[model samples]
Target chain A: MFTISLVGPPNSGKTTLFNKLSGQKIKTVNYPGATVDYFSADFDKKYEINAHLIDTPGIISLIPTSIDEIITIEGIYSHPEFGTPDLIITTIDASQLSRHLILVNDLIEANFNVVVIITMNDILARKNFSIDENKLSEELNLPVFKIDLTKDNGIDELIHFIKTEVENNFEKRVINKISEDTFTLVNKYNRISEIEKKVLFPTKTNSKNITKDFNNLHKPDEISLKIDSVLLNGTWGLLIFFLAMSVTFASVFWLASPIMDLIDSAFALSSESILGIWGNNWFTQLLANGLIAGFGSVAVFIPQILILFLILGILEDTGYLARGAMLVDKPLSKIGLNGRSFAPMVSGFACAVPAIMAARTIPNKRERLLTIFILPLLSCSARIPVYLLLIGFLVPTTGSLTAGIILASIYLLSIISSLVAAGIINKLKNKVITEQDHSSFILELPTYKIPRLNNVFFNAYLSTKSYITGAGPIIMIFSVILWALTFFPAGIDNSIYNENDSFEQELIENSYASNIGKFLEPAVSPLGVDWRVGVAIITSFAAREVFVSSMALMFQVNISDEDSIQKSLLKNMQKAKKSDGTKVFTTSSIIGLIVFFIIAMQCVSTLAITKKETGSWRIPILQFFIYTFSAYFLAVISVNLINFFGIA
Target chain B: MKVRNASQLLNGEQSEILGIDYNHPSARRIIEVGFTPGEEIKVIGKSLFDDPIAFSIRGTVIAIRKSEASSIIIR
Candidate 1:
């Protein structure tokens, strides 16, 4: 099948053009590598034959620097699996024609069947400049089509031209025949200047100044400048960034609750109805208690993820994301990260999967790696439930202020730990923060434009879809396996229970899941953790939030009563005693458990995403070991030291 | 006009890039994004530390660090 690759420089709107051509709803983020990798779709009778339209990483030059750029280059030239693409659709920013044309010249020289689509003509036209299309085509010897995505100008012409001309002449132009001298960065750019000289002409010579005046052309600059005075003012910029992030964080909690509650009740209602019909047999037990509950627990977080994406989408679309980057770059650079790391690090507070994906915006290898390495330590919402359940035992407080302080402290702890980890790695293993890909820290702050609401909704929808699609099956498989492990050995007959709490509690104890927990009891017993904590730890590997629910189930807390669950779980854990009759969650033990949760690499989805993002198990493996060992030793030492000193 | 460091250029001042310190780390990407010699740029704004001073180059507003900007000689 013929593949047409859409290649362009950053900020060229390549993804928008790709979505327009492919009739797909893919989102376009402002930063480079926001898509992370190529997005391809088959022709849906939008053309004559079956062809793949691929949207690659928006790269500046052919010489690849970062991972995303390398992937794009590989897709075109070096991939062992996918052969070279047939036609190249180069998207050029019309206002920045001189710079954009350099990439066009490079592609043309490399002998790719090139069709240039000019975007942002409105911006150019607003500036009293316009390109003569036929003149440009004659100069470049390739068809140049100008598109206005909002209005659909030149799109139909683009399709018809590509269909006819490409079919006739492109099959044989596979080899790059242009000499090194002909395609040097200097030569291509020099030729691009010549083309600009020939084709680009000023329109409507200003009535005031008959010359081409760039300053007067950009009327929007006044408003933008005025806005930036407050928005990008150092102190105000920081304040606004904090406010923006706080709003995003607050919206995740406030706006999504109704939908989340609706989903929870829906799942509960379905499970109850399914159980009502299926009776109390094993099949009913598996469907009602296991599958429905398992999937529903995960499906509830969808709203929060969607809300985060919606806010982030608007921020990026409004071009405020770049300003946020600029605001944080200096501080983050001091800590061995760039401005790009700021967004992903903030996103880590949401979830690591998407945050790791977001880290691709960082062009520096070590900086990107450091961002990913530190991301998991950020106290995500998944850790919220774990913190709530554990902090109740750690400190004797249900007060609002104390709870808020504790929660904020955990987040603070996460940031400090990750920064320390970055420092350690810098000092010991890799000297990362000192050397950089670019000597100058240059980040483009796009002009403030009204964010297109459709794009925001589309981005949110796409982010939620991807998370569900990527993380769902693994969660399901783990849930099912967890169910089977806790259900098998085929009998409540093994442990005798007099009442409801004991019945559910012993049901897990006599099953295979508890046996696995018992297997790790020796390793954990030193930290004052019982077999139940062991089982909760094992179950939470699916996701950290599952630790709370799994604890609720293992302790047989009344799941039906949401209002009383937190109090009951704390009460049950407080009453829990070891085989030797010593209390399980003594003050020090609870602190140790809290420390472990704060540090341990317990989430499977986090590991999966880390492996995918770093493109190797090696980094994730090191990450896993470093985190788990630190968690283990720290927990053990805290427990032992407190006991030795008779402090708690 | 005599050449001066990009960090030394004041707000709203327009200048052309002369060159950058060849040995600096960010020199390559600086040039890659049209920061080469003869490129016209304006010092639009500056952050508190003058670390990330904003510049308008070829109609795009970009922020670069003053430490690295010092290497970017402009006149």
Candidate 2:
């Protein structure tokens, strides 16, 4: 089957054009690779073309700069591993023709079947510039189609062109203009200029007059400059960034709660009905209790994850992330990273797994690694439930501003500490590593545009789906193993968990995990955690929120399954005692627990993703131990100091 | 004619690039992105702290660090 690749330089609306052509809702964010990975789908749905449509990451040249660009270019050339695209749809931003045309010219010369697509023609026309497409196509000797993929204009022409032009491989028709060796930078420019002379009519309003005078400003639009003047101002930019972040996190709670509750009740209702239908056999119990409960806990996270990606998609689409990057560049540079680190750092708030994956945008290898190292320190959505559950016990009153301060402090602590960690690592890295940092904070602040809803929703769904599918099996395995560990050996009396009673609780205490927890108690007791807490902490490695649910189970609370049963959680935790009968959760001890959680590398999936991304177990293993031990030592020292001060 | 590296040009300064140093590994990239000799470019803006100076090359604005700008000679 014929495979066509959509290729262009960054911010040229490349993906937008692909969406128009193929009717596939790939992300059309102004930044590069909002698709994250290459997306291919059956294009038989469009215009009788029996082919697959592949959307490639934006590239500046046939020569690649970053890792993602390398992927796209390698796909284009059809390395034995990745297939060669049968046809190339070169989407050039019409307003930036002179710079974009060089690649188009190269592809034509390289003996590839080429169709030149001039995108952003409306923006060009709005700026009062014109290009004659017939003249351009005649001169270039390839089919040229002008389109504004956003407005859905000239799409039929683009589609018709694709249908007819597949039969005509332009490489057979158009003579190669220059020998490969002679295609130097000078010759490339000359060729572009000659083409420009034939096709482009000189415009009258080139008079932004930003060039001749030093310190003059030129913006394509006045509104953007005005917005940037405030939004990108050092003081204002920082304030607005925090405000934006507050809204982002706030939306995760405010928006996702209803949907999450619905899903939770749905799972509960389905399991209950199934249990009734299957009757009181071991199979029903296994199917209902083990599989349903286990899968339900992990599946509840899907909504929050989607909302996080959706907010980020909106920010990327609007070009606000670039401004945020510009705002943070100076401070980040001191930490051996630059503005590009902002995107990943912000994403870390949602999930460290994807945030670490997002670190690919940072071009420098060392900085990218540093970004990955510090990313887990960010207070991801996974940590929110853990923090809240602990905080409920740690800080008593619900209405107290102190609770908010503690929450805010945790978030702020994560961000600031990660930055400092990056800086310190950067210093050490320079002395040890042989590589020099080549990538600088060279970001193009893309023009602001309204995010398309279809694209945003598409991206959100795709990421959420990938997360579920990729992690689903492992999570299922986790749930099954944990269930077996807890369920088997029934109790001291072989009674199953019929209701919320101390008898069932005794059974849990004598379970395999509780036995393992007893063994782990010595290690965790130093931080004021009991055996049950130890069990929860161990189970928490499966996922963070499980810590709360595990704690709920150990005490056998009537409302242990309810995520919002915080009052019961607090009461139970307060009454929890060590074997010595002294209260386990002291103010100082809880503080220590909080501190330990702040830095501990707890999530298994994050470690798995880190391993996959870094291409080895070396970094992930080092990260796991170093971070966990560091958190342990920090908790120990802080707890000891507090006890000495008698401040609890 | 007095020639200066793009790094030396002040913000909003205009010059035609004379040549790029052949020794630099990324000179190929700088050139490939329409930064070759005799193409007119303007120093558009400097990011905060001025390490990365933005340049308008071939009518598209792109930012490059002073280290990279040092490789391109312009007049």
Candidate 3:
């Protein structure tokens, strides 16, 4: 089969165009290398023989600085098995054709049969710019197809053109050949100039029309000044950014609530029904307690995660994400990061697993590592239940608004700590210098179209499925082990100490004196945690959400009539005390614990991603130690400071 | 005195492009995308960020870099 490669610059809607043509809904991200993996689809028609359309990485030029670029270049030329692409389908954003043509010229000079796919035709029409198709075809002597990929316009025409060309084996006459010497040299412009005079001719009719048109349009200076007035010096831009983020957060909570509740209730019902049928056998208990409860914890969070990804994906698709990056670039850069760093860091708020994977977009290795290292500090959704549980008990005394403020403040603190940690690490490593001199605030602000619902739901489903399949097994096993640890030492009963309490409370009171709790009691004393909390922490390391399920299991066996796990946790925490009779979960200890979790490298999936990205255990191991030490040290200081202020 | 700004170039205006701000992200992007100085470039269109601007050069429809675009001294 003849191979045709789709090539373009980064963020030129190449993937979007490819998706439209190939009928594949590939995930499109804003940053470069988003499409790190290449894909190919077969095109077979009665009128034309079979052809393979391979989507390659977007490259600026043949000389590649990044891995993505190198892969694309190598894929085109160095394939020993596939040989070379028989044809190159170069897609150019219609509004950005001048820049797009550089690659076209190179491919033409390389002697590839090149067909230019002009995308974003709607943008071109809006700008009132019309390409003289015949004139352009005569100038380049190649077939040019204008397409609005998002609207699905001109697709059949494009396919028909491809069919006709392939059938005819159409080859454009080479009017200007690049010399061997010119090809070898680094001066790309000098070589292009050498060929330009022979291939290009200005038409009198088009020249007159262009001059009249130019005289009528707003001058470039006026437009630049207008942009500067709005973006560079205006509060409106910042306000828009914040407003967008607030809506994003609110939507994540609001839209996902119903779905989340449904999933939660379904699991609860299934577990209860299964327990009723199977009775209290060990296998039944495992199924009810281990599999259902453990997976349910993660499964419940999927709706929120999906909504977050969907909103993020839409912002990315609409091109507002680049603007967000640009707006925040200067501020982030002051702390030794860039605008591109924001996406993965924000993603950490949902889950650090994908956030760590998302860090691949950062070009600088040190920056990438630093971003991955500090991402866990973003107060991910896994911490929400723990925070809410503690906050609810304090709200009556502290006031509900104050407690909410404190909770929100802790999240802010996590972000600040992440930045400070990143800055400190960058300073210590002596790699604080920025190499991105080519930082352009300019972004292709794609026309704002209503976000496609199918695209949104499809992405959400795929992302949620991956998380369930990947993290589900680990969480289940961890919960089982935790259940087993607390379930043993069956003869020990604490009914005498809490005689007035129900059978469930008596069981949990016994659990505190269990062997597993006793083993971990000493280690958690400084953090003001008793044995039960210690066991919960250990189980949580498998996955952060497992903390909730572990607590649920602990409480489930201890209390028979407690309807709400949230309420039970609050009540248990309120009565809990330290060795000296001081409250175990004092305001200080609560703050300290929250702080520790915010900074700690608690997620194993994040560590796995680091291992995969770095291709070694060294970086992940180093990250593990650094984040753990930081979490511990910071938590200790916070607790001491809060105690000193008598805030507890 | 000579006019160097991309704005001075009319739509469908053909010019022998002299130089670009290689340090500019748009310039680098354009170069990376496939545009080189000394090529015959035709201005196709422009939008926000002075972006999605298109060019016809080297027998293909290539998009111009949005940043280094203003610095493209064309005649």
DockQ of candidates 1 onward, in order?
A: 0.49, 0.40, 0.12
Better of 2 and 3 by TM-score: 2
lDDT, ranked from best to worst: 1, 2, 3
The interface RMSD values of the models, given in order, are 3.4, 4.0, 9.3
Q: Which stretches of candidate 3 lie over 4 Å from their true place?
A: A1-4, A10-13, A23-53, A71-87, A109-113, A126-128, A132-141, A148-154, A161-229, A232-235, A396-400, A430-473, A487-516, A555-562, A577-583, B1-75
Q: Tell me how far the alpha carbon of residue A236 in candidate 2 is from the true structure, in angstroms, after superposition.
A: 4.5
CA-based DockQ, model 3: 0.12
Tell how far residue A307 is off in model 3, in angstroms.
1.4
Encode model 1's per-residue lDDT on A1-648: one tens digit a residue.
576788998778887787777744333322232332456676546565456677776776676656666666666663333367778899998887777787787687688888888899898887777888889989889988888987988888988877775567546565573343312544455567668757766787544653336444422355667778787777877888788887777677678767876886788678778856764456766787679877986798788788878888889888898888888788777767778888788777767787888787677887888888878887766676688777777666664677667767777788888778776765663533334454225777778889988768966776666667666777777877777787776533433333443555667877898888899899889888788888888887787777876787677775455555667888888788888899888878877877888888877878887887776787787778889899889889988888898976
Q: What shift in Å separates residue A365 of candidate 3 from its native position after superposition?
A: 2.7
Model 1 lDDT at residue A201: 66
The lowest-lDDT stretch of 10 consecutive residues in candidate 2 chain A is A210-219
> Taking the tens digit of each residue's C-alpha lDDT, what string does model 2 give over A419-480?
77777777886542334667665566677789888878987777777566555566667766
Q: Of models 1 and 3, which has the larger lDDT?
A: 1
Native RMSD of candidate 2 (Å):
4.5
lDDT of 3 at A526: 66
- The DockQ for candidate 1, computed on C-alphas, is 0.49
